[model samples]
Target: MTNIPEGKQMEAAIQNSFNEAKKLYEKHGIDVDDVLEQLSRIKISLHCWQGDDVRGFLNKGRELGGGIAVTGSYPGRASTPEQLRDDIDKAFELIPGRHKVNLHAIYADTDERVDLDELAPKHFENWVKWAKQKGYGLDFNPTCFSHEKASDGFTLSHPDAEVRQFWIDHCKASRKIGEYFGRELGQPCVTNIWIPDGYKDAPIDRLSPRVRLMEALDEIFSDPIDEAFNIDAVESKLFGIGSESYVVGSHEFYMGYALSRRKTVCFDSGHFHPTETISNKLSSWLLFGERLLLHVSRPVRWDSDHVVTMDDELLDIARELVRGKLLEKTHIGLDFFDGSINHVAAWVIGTRNTLKALLRAMLEPVDRLKEIELQGDYTSRLALVEEFKSYPFGAIWDYYCRNAGTPVREEWLAEVKRHEREVLCKRSQGEGSVV
Candidate 1:
């Protein structure tokens, strides 16, 4: 059983730690309470694919295509929407912040197999209702892969006009659904477009596919949707499983397109070369892009989509966002799926690590460092950085978790394991559920 502290004792301990940390931060001209409040308000959009391992309801548990793969045979995968939501809610209870949900078009709840071109917002009515009931925000994505039309490793940029048009219509429909979510939830929905349109081997006429993609995107965004209700975005990938040689929507392509079109640019952390880091690009993109959609993930040698951890790279990302004050200009979201362990545990761990990274960044003495830098005291700045590493940030974090009513530290794992025993194990028998 988890050693979660009792009600009154937990509250008192948290308060005592918070009080000491508050004084410590004030000595460095930082406001701990204000930082905590801001952190509480930041919503990390949780990816829906994590719960189900990217296997959507369409085609009845078919494998994922589109340069995506979820390896491992983790028990108790969510086969239905109800099960997915239950698992997601259970994970949220262990996380210490209010967050949003990011959904792909394939996750639409419907009785019939809705074709790509014919999909409508009504299909996701259940999602909107559930999100509203939970007081959560929603984001959307256009599913351009894992279908018959995209079997050739192409969708929006397919050579055949008919196939390309089908994907375009799907994207247009996605934007309309996103608008519906925004209007109903009273928050703008970010509808992102990412297609696995590339060639495995070397191909001639790469420019042609990109041109077709540009035209198709123009058609998808031709209709004006109010920005208040919905914002459109396009994503780019470096390369993937079958698309090793080239990806039509490369970073340069999307960056130029987003700049010219005044659209949000999605900077996926795992979508770049292994040596590259998206954190360094934050300040630069904020100068031109209206908004940035960040897909926070840990890439192991490639876009393997490992669960995020509080590593140096992740810490750098949080620090960049905090130092640049780009939180309001950025839409933070998770974009990884690890099926090697408990799916619920994966979600909780990734989300909590992200929150913890952000807290660490927020607790930094940014102003003092800046003042030292401006005074040309580089020596002091470097020394102060090393010194601040020993601050009582962990105590503050525990307090924050306590106030959020989540299990502090390792205590959350016990709850997840209990859930696995009582809930997940039962689904393994007498059903066509676990894949």
Candidate 2:
């Protein structure tokens, strides 16, 4: 029961623990070194909205509409593109492994008064340059919410043909931006389209809006961008703040549309009913589609988009990806905004939890477990599964973080606090506050 020492002694203890954990995993025929290497190669896209509370630079001072809201007055919300990028830089330093930045169309860095429909690759030149300099890949999305056009809780599915065309043009422009990101970065950029279009009350005609949505999406993807550069994905939601009754792009709608149109379907963890989980749908979707995009989020009561944690569902999702061998075909991205806490800490926590879950899944003796299941030894399978839960996963994770030169365990939180004192607290309330 010796107390753990400070400084140099702590490093030695962590290494000793990792050494013991490595041997324990080797007994189960798992290669700890290979698992760490695999985890290093996996990239999770960190959402930019988390740094700015979803208040994109293009629409400053506008109330967040279309069922979207960021609830918290936490200081140091990045107000400008430069500030947001700086904040993201701080977050990346605390988070291990190389990752990409996910951006909404409204985060366009140009100074010109360009609307969403007028967005071009040139507008995001600064983001591209920043990403290239940091050696990071990039992902793009067309923001269909928080605009006057979406005031009535609709965009692509809006009845007005003119309004529908406006969204269509914006999405088309967004694809071009995605293509530019991939071409410049030499990695395919997933351009995901998620529109908040549904009725708060039961609509007399639910079919029409979906029909319009289908048609609009058809027109939007009519000009096919090369898949090598830009990969298109359609995301669906169960319900949103304003649209609680009937969501036009329901799961079934997107599944039908994506499969029929040969496009990727995005499954948002927070977009499903409380009783349903995206972890169960990966195998089914991968059976038909070539690829899938995942918006890893935590939904408390509904689509709240809370920060992700290493909860049971997160572990199950990671297991499905590893067991089904769907990692290569799935694009992982964080999709939560918590203005209630330190924004950088939120990013570090969520991203690190996701990575830890993946590492845990990878360390499992899957072959042995599967063999037992096939041999009708259900008892042994269940026993092994439960027994492995108490394994020295933390030691391996600490080793990974230390090896990657990032903070180990809870060490990253101290860095977040120092940044808050030296940087975040200095921003004016007006600059940090969100509507």
Candidate 3:
């Protein structure tokens, strides 16, 4: 163990090797950054999803001529009128003109059981006011549904009639807000539909509500005001936890079932089964030729949404979105959050991982790669990921350890420890302590 290459050293080694490997296809004038742009465009989200890991990579990548997009967390919880205005202002100042943020679909709900008549129109005003005042280029997001009053997803799964009614009203409140967003911004302020409503143990009737709920949404879309809203069907995966089996990964299917040809398929990297191939699914989506958005992150195990990855899915998602090969009208967005870990680092790490993935995906083949590219459609990309088709970071780090007068693997392990310490410092905000 002591003689082995450390993790960070391995990472650095991997990165270096990737650079060297990059020379293999430089004939196309294509390198990592260009490929990255084709995917993520280096767009960084602000919420917890755009934390240190992402910033570190973006800073490094941009120094070498890469760009990023900004999509973040505020969009998920800003359902109230006042919250919408404040969040929008921040997005304009922090994220606008950058175009990194294609606007997020945020939810604004307070702890109180407020009547929509009292605040729904105000929610609309908050958005309109922000967009009108900013004069275009303020990329912000909107929310899906109110969940505070209705713990499970509002309007969709609530059992109490009042709870359900309240949710329906708020869904409309969300639309009212959307209208203001589209009218003032000159384009859609994205609204993603992913609900925290479902159970591994619940009856099938729980799904019954979706058809009616979709009908309601259909009615709204029929009016044409919400057409430009960038309505993405955000699909998530369920997990078996200590308390209950949760509901997830069902939204995307429903959105398809409900609207078929109308909505965009927003793929979350971690939302599928571990064996799921993002490249294959995305390719099919491209073949489908609708608008696309992405809710990206990584998995520790399948369905365990740990936002730490240098996984290749990041690359595939970014590339497909940019090419507009699938979801021809794609307006990508992020459905990212860090349930555990230093929330900041989680977001930053997620972002960095996304950037690296973008770079990897952008590694186009030369005329020599014509055969591989022809064979390397989305399905092949997934196999590449599973195949762990990567450079040897361990070998690279070993070479460096030798220069440091240390045994290769031992030096590598030490470097990994050092890196952990450094990560702890950041995570603890200088107070990181371990037992």
Candidate 4:
């Protein structure tokens, strides 16, 4: 057998690499320890939909309408709130640093049968209690899709006054829930609204639906909740399955609305055209807006919602946030569901990659690069940027994971497999079903 270093030996090896990497970074005028501390403070909101594949507790057995779909019949899918929370706990254990959890109106944990419009803060009381116990902040979203009222692919912009009012009421109620969470948790809860109101084919009267949406949004925001507790946001999409031809909430539409109404505009990574990247939009949006909400996701082709990887765009996004000093004004949340693999593993992989990207970005000598560019040394700027790419970023990242008391390198994967065998596999076998 090959002689393999274990336990203390492996730890010593990691420490040696980290020490050498720290020196290299120090030479660049970068404080590796300070960078790690800054990285620890940045929390990404973990979306709860990934655990249950977007199948919320309310309206069980209901098909996922509103242009949403979760591929793969991945085994060990959480069927109940308890299971979902447990799975999320496992993911949190593996991911370094503390984070928040984002919840939808449909994820209300209660036995009382309540429709969307009937939802209240009481329904989410259990969630708040659990979040408090786990020291997690909570974020909320109005569930405007996958409901009977939205069956015709129209929600807040529906022509029928009753139909539109129903969604409006639901959104208003969602705001209350968000406010409650923030009040109890001592952090502002971002309640984002995204509706699937559009036509499958091009319609001549595109203006009417958008006009109705604007009016409804005005009504929803009419009764202002305390901003200290609840911060509202509007998300726009390029296109979805049902709204392929025309999506009411386009980028320009929400950008205009958000600016005019002084609301946060959410930029979902997978919500734009394949060629368009959200990283480029960060600086412009920050210049005009007070705050931003980001839904970081990976799109393979067209808003496919793949698990995020440490790709070029992801690195650029992280770099932009660090360079522009936008982290303080931004709320980072994940938005993707991949049922093909273990849900906990999906969360771990996506979240870890996101943190890794941020760590690499923070390790860069941003001030030096800016100084070089200001000096008109374009050649040196490009050279330094490319050279930093080959630096021992991995060593620093491994050190971060180790210091956080989380897994270093690929050590977390074995834990995921062990959890799958011990906890996840039992769910499928006991229920005799796979999600």
Candidate 5:
């Protein structure tokens, strides 16, 4: 049998490679050590929905509603809160650096069915405890869809007073829970509200629905929670599966609201048209908004919510953040779910790819590039940009994984498969207890 490296031998190998990589980066005026430290501080919030196919444990695995769909039927989907947390833990172990947990209102751990309007902080007590214990910051979302009240595809902008009030109460309650999360975790929780309120066919009274939406949002934000504990954000979608014709909260609507209300705005990667990228829009939005929340997801052609990859758009987004030094002003979170593979593996892949993009961006010689650009040395700038493609960035990334004590490269996949064989498979076979 071939001798496999482990223990001290593996550690020594990683250190040796990292040292060489550090020297290589120094030639380009890049501080590899400082870059690694900065990368460590960039916490990507992992979405909770990926572990359960967006099938919130609400109403006992009821079919998803409100234009949401998970296309694959991969086995080992977490059926309970405990199972989902277990899967998340496995994925987190594989990813490097400290991270945050993003939760939806439907993920509340309750014994009985809790109406959306009646949701409270108590519903999310367990999540707070888990987040505190794991040292993960908590972010929250109000479940504006997948309920009876939202069957008509309108929430927050519903025509009926009673229907609109139901969602408003739910949103208000969700903010309270978000505040509680912030207090417990000692970090401000981003309470984001996204609603699927539109029609499959074009509506004649589009303006009226938007008017109602503005009024409803006014009510939702009427009670101000201390900014120290919680911050509010509004997300807009282009068009969902059911509402392909008209979406109430289009990007224009929320952008206007954020500008007027002076609240943080959210830009979901999959929410825009395929040809339109958020990379160029960052600086523009930053000029107007104080902070922006990013939902890093992949949309094949539409808002399919596929798992994120290290594609050009993803890299550009990370580059924009690094080049503009916008990391601190942006809250990065993953928002994709692919149930066709191991859920833990999906989480690990998406989160790791996100970190990879950020690290690559940080490795760029931005100061030098900008200097050349300012001097009008377009030829040298182009030459330098092309030269950077061949740098030893992988060695530095391997060093980061080693320093973070996470499995380096292909090694993490083995660990995930082992868990699937030993744990997840048993759960699917009915040999393990969940919840």
Candidate 6:
């Protein structure tokens, strides 16, 4: 049984997540299965609301024989444990005993939140305890300080060292908070690190004090925290609010590559474009730069975090990553956020659809791939995806879609909404909202 969500434990980290994540890809055990599961859960939350509405979407997702793999108290430092649990409970009232949550948030803007210290630690601890009693895991996201702190969407980690240390203090307190929550709750927790400290001038010869920033995080987890906290390194793409020209790539790429091996490249699918590599076949532009080796997967539609489109080109690349065992070698997060669609329905469908597409991608051919390319023929592998006879990274989406009953739209939000309306409405008749 999983305990209920409360305070920052529920707000920052959910309960019993990795076990459910492991269970999701159990039958396949095929690396990318985990990728698909990760993407699907992200969709549920993206399509839902920042509060109770998302839990409602998750309530529907659990009934479908899957649960949300990535989610959170959302709306950043503003959420309280009580606010978060309100949403988690509504999810259960819909499906009863079927559901789970993993707390992972993007960058936090201080202007939007009250104060970091204002975070209710005890309430967060109780949520962790309750979630553990029920059987679940928790996760948190913290940002590394960089020069990008003065922006509109940047976290306060930037600014001045004193201000940065304030965040460092938050990290230390968060460790104690996480430790207390995990000790009392009986679940694993994770911390997601996405630093916005990159160069705007492109020629970044001088690597800033990023090492010190990450070291600050090390200080947080260095203590006796019982829960297994994962540090997911985010690969940022494009220039938007608080844009950073550089971000983490491969699992063992720079950053903590030399010291702690706890970091994992949480590739956001949107990097499939000029930012990261997704398709080796679509590497028409790859030869220009040797760095294409670390390209993250994405749809061909130019940097859009579409969340669902299954272009054969993008799937081929992500599949190769999985087939080469890259996907399994580290901790993975779906790495998606709301771009346009604010409604929960649009978000979940796109996420769920990507989940299905990723499953198809895992079946793509990769072993004889480089050799097959030299031969200048695509017939052999093409035959596999079209026929569904090949192993992971083979087989077309059409084949798998039939089995998952996934929707045919560009994103899965429509299908996610359909499920919520059809199934969740009846369940929520007498229950309160989870957020």
Give the whole-model CA lDDT for all candidates, comma-separated: 0.90, 0.93, 0.44, 0.93, 0.90, 0.39
For candidate 4, the 10 contiguous residues with the lowest summed lDDT are: 426-435
Candidate 4: clashing pairs of residues: none
Better of 3 and 6 by lDDT: 3
Cα error, residue 416 of model 3, in Å, equals: 21
lDDT of 2 by residue, 143-224 (tens): 9998888899889999999999999999999999999999999999999999999999999998999999999999999987
Sorted on TM-score, best first, the list reads 4, 2, 5, 1, 3, 6
Q: Give the runs in model 2 whose Cα sits over 4 Å from its true position.
A: 1-6, 429-435
Tens digits of lDDT, candidate 1, 371-435 = 99999999999998888778888889999898888998799999998888888878766632333
lDDT of 4 by residue, 1-435 (tens): 766668777788889999999999999899998999899998999999999899999878889999999998778889999999999999999999999999999998889988999999999888988999999999999999998899999999999999999999999999999999999999999999999889899989989999999999999999879999999999999999989999999999999999999999999999999999999999999999999999999999979999999999999999999999999999999999998888999999999999999998998999999999999999999999999999999999888888889999899989989888888888888544432
Better by TM-score, candidate 6 or 3: 3
Q: Provide the clashing-pair count of each candidate structure.
A: 0, 0, 49, 0, 0, 47
lDDT of 3 by residue, 112-170 (tens): 34444234434334335554665542233323333245334434445665665554554
lDDT of 1 at 386: 85
Q: Write the per-residue lDDT of candidate 5 for residues 138-219, one digit (tens) a residue.
A: 9999998888889889989999999999999999998999899999899999999999989999889889999999999999
Over 4 Å off, model 3:
1-24, 28-45, 48-149, 152-154, 157-162, 200-207, 226-252, 258-261, 316-328, 339-343, 366-435
